[model samples]
Target: MDLDSLTLAYAYGCRNAGDFAINEGSLALLDRTVPDVDVTAVSRFASESPEYERMVEELDGVEDGALVGGPITYDPESQSRPAQLAALARNGLQYGVDVAGVADDLSVHSALYEGITDADAMLFNGGNAIHYSPSHGNLPYLLAMLYPLQVARRNDVPYGLLPQTTFALEGVARRLVVPLLEDAEFVMTRDAITFDYLSEFGLSTQLINGVDTAFLNGTPTAGDPSDGESNRIAAVPRFSTLGDTGELDAAGKRMEDTFLTYLDRLVDAGDEVTLTIQTEIDAAWAERNRDRLDDIGVGYYESYDPDELRAHYAEMDLLVTMRLHAAIFALSVGTPTIGVYRPEWGPKMDGTFRTLDIAEYAIPWDGATVETLEAATADALDEGRALSQHVADNVSLRNEALVSDLRTALSTADGFA
Candidate 1:
């Protein structure tokens, strides 16, 4: 049997530049590690859409397959009953009549239908969207995300959730997600915390310890050392939201204020600082925070290109970031990073730091202060070289584990040829 001839549908919607980096890095890893398998991606929106075209173009090695509109309706009241029923019928035919029809909107269902029906197996990429988070108010969106996995199972196609962070499932969410996971060929979590959380549900057979796929990215070469006069620092910040309101609550406000104080302290210490923006939300936060910084000379960078982004990280002495991929990008490129953990955002950030053996560098958002940030930043800069070496060694081992498990899963699928 020629496994190289098989087709895989890499299904997940790219949300921002960081996501594009992960998708690109995952493809690069698969090409190097597995090789010769025809791959296609299923996105939630059109690759050419104005909002995501750059992110799609930035994905280096992935080929676009289908644009399934997202699971949740932007305007629920606008959908008609007849149109919904028709979509339900189409979804039934594509996934299987037995899988419960959740997404009754035709646009997304059709795209998912085409992507799943045309592929031999599916790989749900790394992200925290698969599970429910109290911070996010999108139960329908989570259900819509899991329905495709159900589709794969009903059709008896091999499918796996790649290295991702999952939260503790509860209530109806547990009921919907557990069965699909039970039948999955493999389920790898990026951290022991999530693995242990899933273990409590007794899905132990499918669960595996896996590292984030971003570690498979090539390491950044050492660049010119910083002048003794000033150290360059990259900081990424995100807006906090609770419930569905566009307002920041007390906790969210405190976290944002702490981040600003941390950045101000960096500027006060005579360091050259830049705000690294990887998503639209980050851009908005940067713009709003810029006024608060006054003329402190903080630069802003938003790059969809991974190489360009890595170069930005390489020139920095240290990264203090709230975004998971921002830290992943820095560490992958041999730049030291201090992760700002948002417990509200689920376990991905801290889990990833733990996986990389740098949990000490992660500061919790609730009680964070400028002094804590300053100390962590100093430690990271002083031990940058040693930490970089540690990251490189661990990344190699994790990449090998990811590839070995993936290859075994693909080879053992019932109809691979």
Candidate 2:
């Protein structure tokens, strides 16, 4: 089969620089496998936002593309209850209208529906799309994705769910997500946990164990062990509602206290601690904790360029981060990372760490203490070179498997070789 003649609609493309890195890496892999294939990105944001504009810039020269206005607005936490309800109602109505063939060309819904209908194949980008226990407030965001997915299935357009993480699903979300997974031409999960979770759903679709596509971000540049004038450690912070049940906030307070104590230990030890922000949400957290972080003399880094970000990670001797991509960036470049994991953050961190044979470096958020963090940091530094080589080898092996699985999925879908 001539793959150049095929057109693939890539969905869930985002503005987050880390996400862009994954999409860019995935596209590069796809291009190498099947040269000159036409690809169009279907974003989850409207064209007017900076998110969409950034996506356009990143996708420039890749292939032809269109907007298809995203169903959910950014920052759902900030929107009023009535406003959220109205947006949900609007999307629900629009999807119904489009499915009924009553949508006019001028309507955004019509354009979105048409993008899927016109595609020869659909590729959902890698991310945490499944929720294990979504609050009532989170249901709408999950529903927003269903319309496009259902449309693709209804139209008989072959679709694949790329490397993704699934936490827990229940109630309405489980009902909708299970059917969607069942309909996918193939499903590639980033970790064993997610693959096992989806397997329980009894979906007939072929499932493949895959690593994060971001591993294709290229080979790691070895860092010099002797050049360490200062013990540079990159620490990433996250803003989480870990225990917001409208009751006692002890869990939240404990998480913050532990994190600060960990940072304080590093600073007191004469290490040059830097707080790196991966997403806008992380930026907001950093700003809110500015005074606290400032008192400890921690530096800040805020950038959207993945190459620049990876370069920053490369300079660090060790990375202590709550963000998955930050850990990935560090590992990709031979810098050992200590991951902080919380139940609310899902399984990506633990999964990725385990996949790379570095689970010993992971610290559970609730169980974290200054002593534990300090010990982990020391261990990472002592074994840095060995750990780095282990990660590099594992990443290379997984990347090969990922590309192979992708090829098999595409060939199976095309019904030709």
Candidate 3:
């Protein structure tokens, strides 16, 4: 059966520009793989934000007039209900609870309800929101993202998970979600570590090792800075290194100190530096470290739109980021990048850099030093032009492979036709 006969619901919801980049690329991938395929974009928010609308318009491959809405509606005060219901349904199914009843009780948005119920299949796009990170212990938020999958099961519609970096699904989170994952038409991981992590579950579903969809995005044209003579550098901060308690532990302090030292040296070298806050959490961290940044004389840059972020990144001469997406955005725009990330944050940074044949640029937080950052930055700057070409070539190669594999998975799925 051809994909043209299928109507797929693409479920995603995140305010992150990095995730938006992934969604944009995922839409592009789907367009290339199934030119005439029908899709409904289901978000978590009850109403589409202005940024979301802008993203849909800016994306080149998303079909025009595609429906966008959320399936579940809840206020911030009681958003946990859907997750609780999902968990209840998961455990109840083993004891013979009706899937249809559970699904009916959970859905709120009419458009998403109709989209999921009528669609032949469903696909989840964007980055790793499934895992339980210590820094982010909002289980409701994570489980709520899986509500559409539960709805798809109730409707007997097959669903596939696109490539993403998901991990740390332990205890209750694993118990609640494993069945849903096992029931997927297929599951794909963008990193090998996650592929192996999921393999431990011994799922019978088709598990494919696919590349991140972000690579599918075209390289953005570099924009000129207001001061054309300035050597501009940017960095993205993430607070995950603060450890399981989500506070500034020794390791987190060390990571911050090392970064501060790097920034000081950059200032000494006459490079204009700024920190990019990609999400609300990053902003919180920046606020907490206001004194630190103020002392270094570095300011924070904020942008919610992925396209806008890419344009800003294009103006940078170099980027030293703790966030993987920030590095990806910078590299996508031909800005040299170095990733100094926490070691336990899984293999995303390493996997991405290795894929680009620039593994040396990804340094573990524990192993990172001012020296290492400086050296990597110097190397990245020296190789900036070559890295851009390399990124383009790899993006082309990986995107082709991803599309080819996705087609295989879709054609073999239980639905379509």
Candidate 4:
């Protein structure tokens, strides 16, 4: 074998969209070349994240000889909790987990990032910002990233990054991770916006302009336009803990008012709906906008398993999404997704909009109102096949090109460093 081990450090909520994106992408790229190598599944997704622990406990009950399905399994049971466990059982590889059931003494979280520095080759994918961007506050995420990167460097392992977005860099980013990204053997980003951002910061990198890594996700969209006219509008609810809600409220009011007016104009137009987590982080805004989804009785979905979640995007004709993976999934499955962005910080979606030449889909923070979202959405749903075709044409090239690029990249990694 030309290469023996290519390790990865995974960050994000366990089984969340971002985590799923990173994990699946890493696997896809690796399978392109080194099929016989060991793939490590990290036990701790985030510091407080319990995916590792939860899966550990769940493993205790597995009677052995179990099968897990990928997200897109056509099975009805695959869309439920049973599917979650089954998927884990089937697809997950045993890594560092010290949860009570395992006889090993090593703590799961500690073991996840423990040995990467000693590996001959390594990769980091879809990590969340621990470095505390302007929007997110100080946390342990950066520390987690730093410890592993430093270890990899000390061992002189060939290191690479897979489509990560960095922010909240006042301290952690500048001191901890960016330098590693700059000096790593190779660095790649999903869209031009991020590629440019890092380049300005002095990183020697390539712009592969990929979807959110999750675009290749196996989950099939319902792809049914049964509610085409009714699924026209969407609302990205805000739940900022750092910024002023006054701004968010004012913005939300303007957009909702605009959407309602548009709703009145088109007798056949559908309504805009909200999606967000119910917990404290962004709950207030999600709760408020949820009423919009409720009042109109529009089709709505809340936080769901990353695997099971693609159905929502598939169900939509158009999406006004703040979540990057949501839009990635929307575009990949041929549903056009409009990325709602904030200033100076949202390269993930903004870049995708530009790279895909779907600039009309980039809805800026100050510029997009619920009304504008509704108007655009109504048109998309009204012209369902046309919109789907547009997304299909743009994204398929990017997705196909990326798969080829990764294969070429993996083949090249044979002698890298």
Judging by lDDT against the true structure, name the best candidate. Answer: 2
> How many clashing residue pairs are found in candidate 2?
3
Models ranked on TM-score: 2, 1, 3, 4
Residues 44-151, model 4: lDDT tens digits: 332233444444433221223211211111122224778756644532333212111244345432444344633567666653333355344434334535545554
Q: In model 1, what lDDT does residue 108 have?
A: 38
Q: After superposition, how far is residue 187 of candidate 1 from its true place, in Å?
A: 0.8
Over 18-133, each residue of candidate 3 has an lDDT whose tens digit, in order, gives: 76678777777887787777766765544445544655555555466564655344443334887656745543442132224344555433555566666667787756657766
- Quote each prediction's TM-score: 0.84, 0.89, 0.80, 0.72
Each model's lDDT: 0.67, 0.72, 0.70, 0.53
lDDT of 4: 0.53
The root-mean-square deviation over C-alpha atoms between each candidate and the true structure, in angstroms, is 4.5, 3.1, 5.0, 9.2
What is the C-alpha lDDT profile of model 1 across 293-391, one tens digit per residue? 666667778875556777789888888888887887777777778888767677887877787788898788874787788888888777767777776
* Candidate 1 wrong stretches, greater than 4 Å: 1-15, 46-56, 63-109, 220-225, 242-245, 412-417
Supply every candidate's count of residue pairs whose N, Cα or C atoms clash at under 3 angstroms. Answer: 0, 3, 0, 8
lDDT of 3: 0.70
User: In model 4, where is the ten-residue run with the lowest total lDDT?
Assistant: 65-74
Residue 69 lDDT (model 3): 53
Query: On lDDT, who's better, 1 or 3?
Result: 3
Model 1: clashing residue pairs?
none
